[model samples]
Target: METSSVLIINLLVWFLLLANVLSFSTFEKLVLPPSVTGPESASFDRGGEGPYVTVADGRILKWKGPSVGFVDFAYTSPNRTKIACDGTNDLKFGPICGRPLALSFNYKTSDLYITDAFFGLLVVGFNGGLATQLSGGYKYLSGIDVESYTGNVYMTDASLTSDSTGRLLKYDPRTQRVTVLLSGLSGGGGPAVSSSRNYVLVPDYINKKIQRYWLQGPKKETTEVFLTDCGSPKTIKRAVNDGEFWVAVEKQVQQQPVLTEPQGLRVNGSAVVLQTVPLTQFSDMTLAVVQESNDALYVGSSYTDFVGVYKN
Candidate 1:
């Protein structure tokens, strides 16, 4: 949690996550615009029309199409300046420029929620521009997801305490209150809810597993390890086609953490590896999230200036 400044740029280098892609194929690079970099996480609208990404320059850009390319959708910092912050990877400008990490959309409300490293939770209307902060004072905010049914937002953070533990927290939009759902998390991306809403999976990146927190059941409020040896999952997202999850993972060598080849692992609730998509084709880029929209996979990275999409 103390690694506040170091965390902004070295997220993938420290802990990682990703979605799903197919096997035996290469990712088509969606090279980012000038000066912008590290499309760390990707999200699509309810209408299935995008892969709007949060970039290093502290702005979220929407991909309109190949012709229109990426246009500024929303920004986190009210003090953000195009001249000073645009397209730069420097962490010193985070507080002034607002370093955003993960984003999700409320399908019903059509409001986009974001987790900014410096600004905490922020939201913008469907119209997208400068975002309004909902909450702040969180340290090392990473992943975020919204439950469409309740409109409640759940997220993970490396807490500010010296305990060196991560936490899974929930925000109720109705009450505008934040509560700690679970603590002692190894901490990765946002908690992923089951389709049934019975439980949510929070990735423990350092431990290379996912901790499942029960939301509804006899086991409600209990915590358990759902998946082990999950290859340092970067991001855990619900799959587009199946009732499963696509996790971006990095294979660990000899139990010591090393950033080696990153891959896409699709798995079911029973902890079965359904499919593995080799992502070594991207070469040196440390791929973070491989989110799927419509039918194609959109891959984002913390070390590159592009979001690689897999095309047939």
Candidate 2:
């Protein structure tokens, strides 16, 4: 009996080892250019041709597959010159170099809308050259989303100071007017419009909460708390599935003042979390964006030079 029990235990151990190997096999690291550090957010074009990302050096790059890798796609500011901004992450040069933080595609017009930390809101056409600035008075722009049904762009200003001076703004393409939707947001992250275009979700990084703002329903213009106690949630992106979203959460060690783990949560419109995917392998990095598509997970970090891809 003892011999038989030992054999069964060995088999179980081997099975567990195989499972771990399989999980690791599904993960792949895609390295970017040495200068392209901090890919804060990513988006795909209408033709599904890109995982186009905004980097720290004030440029947007588009992935052209393994053979070609990422190529220059757009720049936020007209003043940004290759010699001045190509490889630097200096905050002092942000106004001149243009650090783009968030981006979303307007499917109808094939235009990409961007939110730059120093340049305010901007957009570039499908051809992708110099981005045109639409607004210019934000202290720190962070998140952006475009409503496909109506070319309305929604974005968040992270903060004016360490205090709660963050706000949500909407820019209408039809009228060329920008309106303040909500004020007093405490360090906002990403804003994602619902698939139905009736609502939008914005994350509050300082308060660790996600807020839902209504756009077209009876609750139009009303805002409410969607999820609370989310661990330093950064960017929120719509999932491939209807009514679902992927949120990046930076889990920090309580005593160390450092991020220990990063996680992605799949949540529904009702604010119920469906699944929590562990992204701890990112190693000492805070994941700024978690997007899922085609049975694969695309992870972005604000301090790393590479994007992690995991087969789901």
Model 2, TM vs. native: 0.89
- TM-score for each prediction? 0.88, 0.89
RMSD of 1: 11.5
> How badly does each model clash, as a count of residue pairs?
9, 0
- Residue 73 error for model 2, in Å? 0.8
Mind giving the per-residue lDDT tens digits that candidate 2 earns over 56-172? Answer: 888999999999899999998778899888989887888788899888998888999999988888999999999998888877888898997889999898664557888888999
lDDT of 1 by residue, 1-312 (tens): 668867775775444333233243655777679878989988999988778999998999998888878899999999999999998889899988988989989999999999999999999999999999999898788888898999989998885343438889999999999999988766456567877788888887777788889999899999998898767776888887556887888775444544567777778888788778777765556566878776667888888787887653
- Candidate 1 clash pair list: 16-234, 17-234, 17-235, 18-235, 18-248, 19-290, 35-87, 36-87, 143-190
Q: Rate the local accuracy (lDDT) of all candidates.
A: 0.82, 0.85
